[model samples]
Target chain A: MDEMSAESRYADWIAVHAGQSDLRAWALAADGSVRAELTLPSDSAMPEAPAFEAKLLDTIAPWLGQGSTSVLACGLTGLADLPEAITPVPAKPAERLPIRVSANDPRLDLLALPGLSQANPPDLLLGEETEVAGFLAGNPGFDGVLCLVGPRTVWVQISAEEIVSFQTAMTGEFFDLLAGHSTISAAVASTGMDAEAFVDAVSDTLSRPERLSQRLAALRGQHVLQQLDPSVARSRLFGALIGAELAAMRPYWLGQQVALAGPSDMVDLYARALDTQGVSAPRHASDGLALAGLARAWFAMQEHAK
Target chain B: MDEMSAESRYADWIAVHAGQSDLRAWALAADGSVRAELTLPSDSAMPEAPAFEAKLLDTIAPWLGQGSTSVLACGLTGLADLPEAITPVPAKPAERLPIRVSANDPRLDLLALPGLSQANPPDLLLGEETEVAGFLAGNPGFDGVLCLVGPRTVWVQISAEEIVSFQTAMTGEFFDLLAGHSTISAAVASTGMDAEAFVDAVSDTLSRPERLSQRLAALRGQHVLQQLDPSVARSRLFGALIGAELAAMRPYWLGQQVALAGPSDMVDLYARALDTQGVSAPRHASDGLALAGLARAWFAMQEHAK
Candidate 1:
């Protein structure tokens, strides 16, 4: 089949998701094969609805093509869940039906998905649901915990195609806040990840999590008084926070077959922290999972249409 | 003796201390009586050395007439510990020798006290030691844990006029970061602390401090989803951080008589939190205690000089 006719054989689609600071887009073939993926800085002014829609389309223009490629996007806040496309489904754990929005744009066919919300334990996820959908699609009958380690790290318990219970930690966000703006910023470097300090600090905090606040301040004190290395201080701060998080998340991963999906650095930290807890979590690439998730949702829509 | 002759008899002095954001000055009569007290915003450029000194002198000029009054200042950071007047003393539990700096300013006879340092467990205190000193002087023969709660809250175990051991927590600093700049800022009001939420949060977190980071994020989530009152959120955040601090300091207060000295709001929180732990810590006025501590140190210097 020629390239033009071959493209015509399958419906091409685009999957886009908005994050705290960025919007991610992935072009996919009908068979759930990712063709291209890219990211653009997102507008945080989420309440200003149509402006963001215009921004989203403008951001993804480079990937938009001549073909009638359908766009499937997900947003957690109400802005993405337009009244026209919303289909409220009964809440279930493994998979909840996402409300969708029809992108009323002439350049491309677009559908935006509603973010997931759980009443019990009360949690929310904006763009991560598609990633979970994609991961579940790849690992059929996967019954375990799915942890997405990022600015907003989330741990979800899944069984029999339902999300059982989940919890989130602002661990990554806290690290950013401290390292970027707080007094501890002096003791933390921007890019270096100290493996030894990370592991040791994790062990130290897990053994004595109550000393968290003191230890956090001690990073600055140690730097001034004890000659604590800035790189190690950064790692220790990271490790201490993640360590405390794992302490609270112990019940979630203690006996579960755990896996992580996120950026490399965060997943590495999460995976390493879990190892110390005697829980080994394998990591999958975040981009693939996100793209696969969008494709899965698009295909599911087609099936439902039939 | 008349008031003027009485002031001249013993040589009146002033004790000033620099805090994280404010400079507190206390005027004292020859007999260690507090004559007057006031505060001014501190120059944050602490490392510049002379600026703080200038600021100290400038802030206290209104109280500094040509009365042959001596001035002693305490700096939390070593920045204020200039070399000229330093008197090194042996490290003891209740007190460590503070390095003193002769202000050398033509306007007044000034000496600046250095903060205390511990070689093991590696800790530092700026101005609190003076307050602790003054606290001890008034309550002579008093023995137990003295907690000076502020930006850097310190718990000192004292016995026989020596600081036996001390620990520090940056609980106040962490709350400032979260409530002012971090993600939790969205749910926190700049002013108005909620006492009920503070107590309840203290109780909840005292039992489960490992969940500190999670509970913090939950405050924002609760605000977004459940419309949690902003004041309550502020109190909850305050309670959680303080509760964690109390958890770590449990050893210091569990079986010991505890008393608090610091800003009223902070001391009240600590006292309330301690009360929840079944420990009744008598609240002492911070300004008076700080002045007393400085006066005690000055008199100790007079005795040492003789």
Candidate 2:
């Protein structure tokens, strides 16, 4: 199917499900024009396997009733329980296998669509590059990637070609830990970070990274001696450590773009850091990325079948 | 004087001080017998200098106002702010200073006792042979000694002696760091510990105490692999390490007694641990230990002057 027909078909399926009491829909508009729309069940509580399957059928039957709506997609394994009328899209190898709703009947169309799968993958896939590569190698029918970064950063890189992955320590998380709980943490308390002081400390340490351990020790000593507040020292230590990590990781993504993900405030801070280093900002979106990526992956799979 | 005369004298003093709006009276009773009393101008907050003299004055002032109430007969800090009126009651070198107060400082009288120099003493006097020796050595007194036994197990020891001292560590705190925020912390989420698990771990490792490092490594591995709950492992690690410290310190106390002081709940727990190990429970009280010790010291100074 051409792009226009494919778009029209997806729209009709959404429209048929729009009035269903059990479904919730969200539409995104660009320049006053509806760009895309997605729906989920309003009362989609899955009970037992059979009940879950019934709900899945109830959710999708209307969409399937629109004969033109040929493809039904879900990122959860629960959707795999749908009647054969709903074609369950196979997850790309890079994507996570939907959690089995029941062990006895594994053939149920309960599998989640590519959108949800790509949006949030399994915890095991987080921060593991080798596993990401393995996932991609196994599932070549995925397109697009969604990366979650912050306290526990996760990358869900996807393409119809498969998933590629790498995981890194949450330097931000480390910074928080040191600030809040460590003996070194006490030094920074009561003293808010002086941005200039932090930048100076970071710059100094980045130039001579081996001093990080010694600096931490000294800061801890000063705190115990009551010479410094723990919080201030904590902020400085965090800034220095994260700065070092960033400096180290800079070479890895030299040319490749990285999309900013996670809480907006954190993303803003990261964006500022990236801007300072003269790196280009990567494209970013919340839910849209997963939806568009899933659509693209589904379209590619259809073309391959044709 | 008989009890009636003593009561009459106290009443007169109280009447006199009652007219002084700024003065506050605090009565001391031992085993339901009126032992001593003190009255002070609440406006004259505890001063920071001439530490011993100020404490002595605060201790005996009320008794002196009652017309030479015999300190030798009572053997207590006779009233507040008149230590010179009391005769010193010499004590055995190892005997803790004698003073008594209620469990919590619920009464304003108990709190109004001039600052009992207590808390951390100067480092030089730590591990001194006796409280008397500590006093003679010019060791600053302590108000209280808070002994943390494990992550959640704490024992507060108050010094009924002229000088007080205590120790601290990062065992429980470090466990929190490792289990809550560290890379390895994630491994132990959702694990539970049997009450005996830690005790068993400690006992087993006692023969080869150096095995602690190895056990820690194993626990860390299990946790990081998500085979154990981080909290359980963290608590276990804390209990094991603290248990080891207790085991080491138990021998040093030998036949000597120890008073567990702090919040009643903490003292009870420590007492239970000691009981399980067949250690004898000594007298435990909270507020007046330091004050009593200071009072005894003041009496000693008065006798020396005489």
Candidate 3:
């Protein structure tokens, strides 16, 4: 079976399971078109899953149960434990989605899927990457592509023939390190955001990004001498650092419409801040893109008789 | 003239000056009785004569022109140098107002009033006991009483028959020493008030006022690597000390109406805090109540003859 027939089969399975419940689905086409859409109640209690899985369910669940909704999950083994009703599809090695391995943690290799390449898998993604690569190479018929971007920011770029590509930002990890452990952490006094101060600080950094490194010293001086009011300064520092990351990533996401998947409050604040710089408010999705991505890969393999 | 006749005559003079454009009269009373009164312009500039003559001219100039006022100056060695129209009334040794003397200053003895008893004055009055007693004895005909409350909180109690007393408070001085100069001052981070944290610390001290002295330990601990938030603890210590003073003074000021005369903002805050303990708001008077009390004493003697 070719990739087209395999994608149709996976779409059929999604439509059947979605109709049985209140699930939604969206068929991601080859040319970046989203079709076969359906909507579910906004306040629906979604199935609990890992962070990535939950994201995918939220996004695709809205479009599920409408008809035969096609979704291409590039890696199957990663979604093997997902709800048994969702079939896994697979695709060729060339069509397989790319997973960048930046950190070399050992435990991750235990979870790697076939056809997933790791330039430096550290010690973790080694096993899982091979399995993921094999699953994708065995079947050339997955519908959509799922791209896992870094450990925190994940993007699921969908297409009917295959998932084209996706990207992730290390935003959450960066925030944790900066606030939790570094000397810079001491400069901030409060965890909650102050909107006006934050906006002002971000605007300052955006205009003079080169001064980013010097911000830590200024914050420390103000706090030590009791010259700066702490509440205002803390909010400003958080905004400035986050602004620096956003500035760096501007080129990749310039024209792309993306969904946000994270803690609600943080996402809301980030969205508001992003909107100030002309970024659209992100669409929130519930389904774990990785699970759907994996299921799509499995079904493709079955269709190929691999 | 007897005390009653003396007071009545002064009152009449004040009434006469009250109608004059350049004359104003103020009297200080003690224990519901008039002790001294003086007359001057409702808006008089500083007098130009020698200290004693200037004080006298300030009193009569409002009623008589320079020519008529000098005519009253005959036979007075202190008055001979004055314009003939101005009369120099001999101030009674009994009517001399007491001058405040610093407890530690040796220069105080040179100007000590003669013929006054060197005995204990009231504790509510500020200054050395000898100075207050001496002034009261030498200035018997003076109805104005100079009462220095503490180093900063000064009150002049005057009456028409004799000058009474004045008092001052050292509260501001104490605050300056603790928060600006001493070792405890070094511990505090120079910062604006953190209202909630400060109030909490103050309330804590209120419960254990006896421990007020040791509360500075928290600030010192932070300074010496005790791993506490130094800025917060320092503010708390300051608040606690202020609270302690308030607690101490509450007993002395029961039921009587007291006026606060100082910097507007500090007075306002202190009044608000005092109100929390059922004390009424203090009326704010202008500064230099001490000088005004002394002037009132001088004028009271002049009125005794009429």
Candidate 4:
């Protein structure tokens, strides 16, 4: 089974999200179990169309079998108005479709899926849409806000399997800048998450959003004034940024059914933040969602194939 | 004169704000005219007492005469509760004194000024305090909000010649990061300012402060969606950040007599922001304000000398 023999190609589907710096793919066995996963840095070259396709194939070559299998992909950035793709928001979930991209790999029938986009506010999500779709597929009739805390956090309003509206915050990028790229890096520890400090900081900023900048400086101030613990500093910074985000995103999570889908620790933070608002959210692990979303897309394409 | 002469050193006072990256000083003649100005990078070495003084004298060597002079200085970071420094807040302006630093450079009698500190908020202003003092000295009996828009913007409320309260915003550093250092940098022109777009952006963020992060991402979205002009992108980003800042700082400028002190262009932007709120702010050129502030301290020191 470990060998890449012809019989090994029994996997039914694969899903790939070609991000700017990294490429991640999931392979689903015939029984819909995630059979294999692959991750590789995509920074070897810019994603010129053919090169990107070839790179995707090279990264997942081990999982490929001589048997033709359907593959679905989504890039890190969204593509709009693709003829084959579904307009998730403007249409009913049951009638929606995923964008289909032509991939010229011999062993795979590859179709690239479209990410979500909003026309009026001009919002876009490339890869996370599939994850959301997968989450919806698993939890049918899930209606409420889904918060995905990733490199960019997206808060989407989902009702009856449809994405109503969504907003993205630069939470992760902001965190990266504060912890490693900005002036405050010297004063904060990039590691460790202090639950208590994170909660308090979140609460502090939520009440006084006007003091966001001052409080940011106070991270350094406390570092100087009281020898602030590095873990505490990290927590404070996270809390402040997230607090500001929550303030902006209050309408989405306030007194609503909230579900969080992202990495475990990030989901934990978001869960805790919402908890303070007297809102309880169910936490879901986001592993298999991408493949599930791709499987959905593949199933849709089969309808097209017929 | 091309030559450094003894008579040239006859200036009665020197004022310096030793910053993290640069040192700026002003030489005050006996009659209070700015005799000369000097600036140099402060990063040649750490600001140890001897080296800092030596570096200070060396940079202002051409302006120094043989005459004994009192030097007043402010470091870039606050030193709270220093015995040698006077606590100005809650003290009458007439009774305030500079924090005297013992300098090895015998060419001048140097007294380092103490920056302002806020205990409740854990805020500090190292160099801007002197500038505020200078602006107050120049515009005596003026009581309202004074905004010094520099590397760090400070809004101070003044009444009866005493510093009432102030708030600091990392506007400048935040702008630098967003335009030149962050992921959005590529989408924005790091140089030009688009006045119209700026004003519009400021208004947008002001109304929806919670959408700041979402709007930041929208800068990039606009780039892809509409091919947003780099200059316009820059303007919009600036406007959004400042707008969010203004939203937080509404109490300072709303229906208050506002005064701005900083570089001309920065003051212009800030003035325009206040103007939108029906607050007309007189812009004061920040040049020589530090020296004037140090001069104020020098006069106070003379009273102590008596």
Q: Which candidate number has the best DockQ?
A: 1
Greater-TM-score candidate between 1 and 4: 1
lDDT, candidate 1, A1-306, per-residue tens = 124454444337777777666787776676767666678775332334566668766766656667556777775334554333332222232244434445557666656666655554555666666677778888878889999887778888877766666788888878887787665777786578899899988988888888887788776556656767888899999999999888778878889999898888789999998898789899988867666666666776787779
**DockQ of every predicted complex:** 0.32, 0.06, 0.01, 0.31
Models 1 onward score TM values of 0.82, 0.38, 0.29, 0.80
To one decimal place, how large is model 3's interface RMSD in Å? 25.8
TM-score of chain B of 2: 0.40
In order, what lDDT does every prediction score?
A: 0.71, 0.38, 0.38, 0.72
- Please give the lDDT score at residue B297 for candidate 4: 77
Question: Which sequence of candidate numbers ranks them by TM-score, best first?
Answer: 1, 4, 2, 3
Model 3 TM-score on a 0 to 1 scale: 0.29
lDDT (0-100) at residue B284 of candidate 1? 85
Question: Which of 1 and 2 is the better model by TM-score?
Answer: 1
| Model 1's DockQ score | 0.32
Candidate scoring better on TM-score of 2 and 3: 2
Q: Compared with the true structure, what per-residue lDDT tens digits does model 3 show for residues B1-306?
A: 144444333322211121101222333222213334454433111122244344444453333312221111111112112222221222232344322222222211111121111111221221122223234444443343232222233334434433243333334434444465433455565655566666666566555553443344234324433334556655576566546555444433445344444456456545554554566654443333323333344354346546
Quality of model 4 by C-alpha lDDT: 0.72
Query: Where does candidate 1 stray beyond 4 Å?
Result: A1-15, A25-38, A41-71, A76-110, A189-191, A302-306, B1-15, B25-38, B42-71, B80-110, B190-196, B302-306
Better of 1 and 4 by DockQ: 1
Residue A174 of model 1 has an lDDT of 81
lDDT of 3 at A223: 45
For model 1, the docking class works out as: acceptable
lDDT, candidate 4, residue B16? 77
Residue A176 shift from truth in candidate 2, angstroms? 5.3
